[model samples]
Target: MSTEKPRPTFQMDGHDVPFDEGQSILAAALAAGRYVPYLCYHPEFQPHGSCKVCTVKINGRTHASCTTPAHEGDVVESNVDELNDMRKGLVQFLFTEGNHFCPSCEASGNCTLQAVGYDLGMTSAHYSPLFPDRPLDASHPEVLLDFNRCILCELCVRASALVDKKSVFSLAGRGIQKHLVVNAESGKLADTELSVDDKAMSVCPVGVILRKRRGFQVPIGERKYDEHPIREVAVQKQKGE
Candidate 1:
């Protein structure tokens, strides 16, 4: 007689979704082939609900799904008009806040922010552009840091501290003034121990981090999220497709 406990299940949009012992609602939903859009929630790292792109209604309450733990029998509502409208507004705010000129960006087709915008049917940034005066850093021999496109996702900061063990990046200031900074006395990438091959370099979801010589090598239309929508690509990637 095999006595094994069944995985705990939750009700998400009229579907029964099973989850592991410590899985978050977002993680469980993605694992169950349900797409909850996100920006700063990477599966490999601890949940940093900074983006709020994966916000969903649980038991009639709004919550960031990436940080909220999944409980059996809880009613979670995703893929709804109200929640999606809020998400679209959030995406638009991100676009207007950043200088994301997709046509000239190297990470144009592969950028997660852009992909999420497209997924949410964002035709324009409903808000006015900020046009913040951010500086570009090309001090590193092999890397380029463009603060103009940074969405303050902090994936690189976490990756550097946790995976790379270099603590190469961090955020500074508060509220609207808050921005990413390099961890160096001279405040430059060339002074830090960041390498082009570090996990931090590859974790940025936008064009903020780019290799010095590798710009648009794959071309625009043939990039990862070019033909497929972010929802399809993200779920497929999670399923190892």
Candidate 2:
């Protein structure tokens, strides 16, 4: 008799998905070759569940798949039209809330938000543009901060505090006023201990944190998302490709 136990499985969109112990629904699904549209959920960090883009129905009620634990025999619905429409709306809101003029943005092809927007078939913003007049932070000689392009995912904040061991970034205000701020008395990246090699510098899913004078080094069309859709790239990355 074998001593090893069988893996727990869940029904995702009618397909059987086997998950390892302590895996979130999002993590397990990606590992099982299932693609779920998400923005704030990164496999590298603990599940934030801030962005509800991965919202899926479990049994009857909805939950954020990124934070939801996988259980045996749980019926999860993710790839349905209803859920996809809701995800699309969330992406649209993100687009309109920020000045994501994709053509003019440096993170156009490489941006996870833009890739998720495409995966969800977001044809238009649908809502009127907020166009919040946010200031750009160019005080850092090695990095550039474009506040207008930020979706407030807080990847940088978590990365700085956890991985890099430096609390370089943080969130301020609440709700509509909630935004990213550097942990500096002068409120600037240059004043903080942030470096180009820090984990926080590369964790931004958008163009908010970028290296100065390093634009288009790989060329626009040759970027990561440019070669493969984020759906494929994200899952492949999780699979250690």
Top candidate when judged by lDDT against the true structure: 1
Backbone N/Cα/C clashes per model = 0, 0
lDDT score for candidate 1 against the true structure:
0.93
Off by over 4 Å in 1: 1-4
Q: Which lDDT value does model 2 have at 147?
A: 90
Q: What is the C-alpha lDDT profile of model 2 across 1-241, one tens digit per residue?
A: 2359878899998899998777899999999889999988878898999989999999978999999999999999999999999999988888888888788788888999999988888889999999899999999999999999888888999999999999999999998888889899999888999889999998899999999998878778888888889889988988899
Q: What is the C-alpha lDDT of each candidate?
A: 0.93, 0.90
Per residue, candidate 1 scores C-alpha lDDT tens digits across 1-241 of: 1249778899999999999878899989998889999999999999999899999999999999999999989999999999999999998988888888888899999999999998889999988899988889999999999999998999999999999999999999998888999999999999999998899999999999999989978998999898999889988887888
At residue 215, candidate 1 shows an lDDT of: 91
lDDT score, candidate 1, position 206: 92
Rate residue 59 of model 2 by lDDT.
93
Give the clashing pairs for model 2.
Answer: none
Worst ten in a row by lDDT for model 1:
1-10
RMSD, every candidate, angstroms: 1.6, 1.6
